[model samples]
Target: MAEETADDYLKVIVFQLKEEEYAMEVDYIQSIERMQPITRIPGVESFIVGVMNLRGVITPVIDLRKRFNIESMEYNEATRILVLNKDNSEIGFIVDGANDVMDIPASKIEPTPEVVGGVAEEYLRGVVKLEDRLFTLLHIDKVLNKNNEEKRTVV
Candidate 1:
């Protein structure tokens, strides 16, 4: 066993999902964009909302609520799409609304519990406790890699 160092402090972009707080590593995020018109594509997973032209790039967007089997809600003014880079492929995840960036030290993040919220436990890195708030840390790779392939994809 080794002592956690300064590198253990995880910088995360926190957001709201079904009224609960969730977070993902800032390193994997590209940018947070406002909800934009998504061109629907048929024959894909239900969670796959559609693709959008981000600047000159075509990016696929997924509704995190639908992906996690959480109750769907109307996209409001605060709704946002989190741009993510994995390997060379870029994707987007629509969340309830993005909040703030917070750094949670390793000791503050607890291991995934049997049932955290709507998302499957396996897709979670852990949960963070800060004062009266709790933010579930999302494992972006696991959430996007449906096949669980070992191949590393760099964004």
Candidate 2:
């Protein structure tokens, strides 16, 4: 008989923030591209950089660093925007740089620990231990929910 293996898997899109690595489900990501000009929206949340014309569609961009309360860094060669879709709404997330796509098996993923720095427990989905390194998986829905709630309260 063949040994049964856990099929727990996630299609993740990895990216960099500061010197750490993070990832989110690919299904939530619509597109990825280099940083472009943005139109600032007055009175909007500071985390919200502005809106961008994405192939004729105006999409709001969020600076993930600010959203997470991390110190902001200037855009560089590795900077890119990760377009995400949630609840039928498209939102763009600015990331430091994008890495390769990785399929993480279920066994490799574990519940996030409490000691991870610069990351809130609510925003984390899980921790994937790959080789000797750890990758933080983000819960996009939770993050977006918090953003939407803040927007509503402000309006």
Candidate 3:
């Protein structure tokens, strides 16, 4: 019934990557899935866990823990794969879990400070503070660019 200004608010999908929470614009997300068998690929970046079949599509999966250089952990019932469509290609990020879809007002987002814990600044767009909780909003372009540019595959 009313116009929604893109700059006035953001709709993000929040997910856990260790103890901290991270978010990405829901526009980029295709689906959230339970952990599935990822067939290993050789010679790609260590963070790129492998590929998995989603229905009929073979999607590459990246382990967020490994990507952020976080300590490795076992994938339990809580583990999830965040499938995202970038440049018409689907890629999945394996995270601790994905739980919420929240709408955050633009005024609540702050530019990332000089120093922040976990995940690199290059991969971050900004930080969102909602009440007492903080969420690191991901820079999907930068996060997905490396994978797209490299297009690495080795036998």
- Candidate whose TM-score is highest: 1
Query: What lDDT does model 1 reach?
Result: 0.90
Give per-residue lDDT, candidate 1, residue 98.
Answer: 93
| Cα RMSD for predicted model 1 | 6.2
Q: Please estimate how well model 3 matches the true structure, expressed as its whole-model Cα lDDT.
A: 0.89
lDDT at 107, model 1: 88
- Candidate 2 accuracy as lDDT: 0.86
Clash count for each candidate, listed in order shown:
4, 1, 0
Task: Give the TM-score of each candidate.
Answer: 0.89, 0.88, 0.89
lDDT of 2 by residue, 36-129 (tens): 9999999987889999999998999999998887899899989999998877888999999999798888667789997879877788988888
Off by over 4 Å in 1: 1-5, 148-155
